[model samples]
Target: MSIITFEHSFFTYPQQIKSLISEGLVDFGAWYLMNDEQTSRRFEGLQTRYPDRRLYPFAKRDDNDDIACFDGSDNTTVHVIHDFANSGWEQKEIFPNIDAWLEYAEECNLQNESS
Candidate 1:
């Protein structure tokens, strides 16, 4: 049900992500993919605020301000950025791709739900 429906032509999500969406597997527990407007707005804001980083935000954590974004240079590797980080991109955690991120998100969700 988390499959995103983008209105804008700005969908540069990785092929793996697209494949998962096509297979109806978009939800990752607490991490939800953003809608077109949300993605676009957050992408713009992130770019302006952190010009050194090339990030394309696609998802956000429901409980906090953390965001999951694709590396704009490759559109494959995923980065999880923490809002509390004063060092900005330095505090971002890298995942090999959306697949790894999905696994991590699911694990985190399970832990959160059990507690």
Candidate 2:
């Protein structure tokens, strides 16, 4: 079963991301929506140390051992940073945008249900 829990009230996430969570659109395993601080702490060198770009991490993939996924501010793409001590994100884009990501998440959850 997929669970939606929000505990990081001290920080604010993107508007579209909040909408997806509120509307019950996300079910990518256990979505651990973390604030900037928590995300930085968990992901280590990848997020916090990168001074040149903005990476706002909001969730991790529980099924995938909490691989951190974050929002890249300039573009509509959400990036996946799978490695620790890496200054920048991996070359592949996690999702094109929030809307498309949510749709794919929904599909992934549905597939999990039939498994």
Best by TM-score: 1
Worst 10 residues of 1 by lDDT: 1-10
Candidate 1, residues 20-76, lDDT tens digits: the string is: 656866567898778667888887887776777777887888888888987666777
Clashing pairs in 1: none
Q: What lDDT tens digits, residue by residue, belong to model 2 across residues 19-76?
A: 6668765545544455446565554544455656455555666676334355444435
- Among all candidates shown, the one with the greatest lDDT: 1
lDDT of each: 0.74, 0.55
Q: Which stretches of candidate 2 lie over 4 Å from their true place?
A: 1-13, 21-32, 35-37, 48-54, 66-72, 85-92
Estimate the overall C-alpha local distance difference test score of candidate 2. 0.55
Per-model TM-score versus the true fold: 0.81, 0.53
For model 2, which pairs clash? none
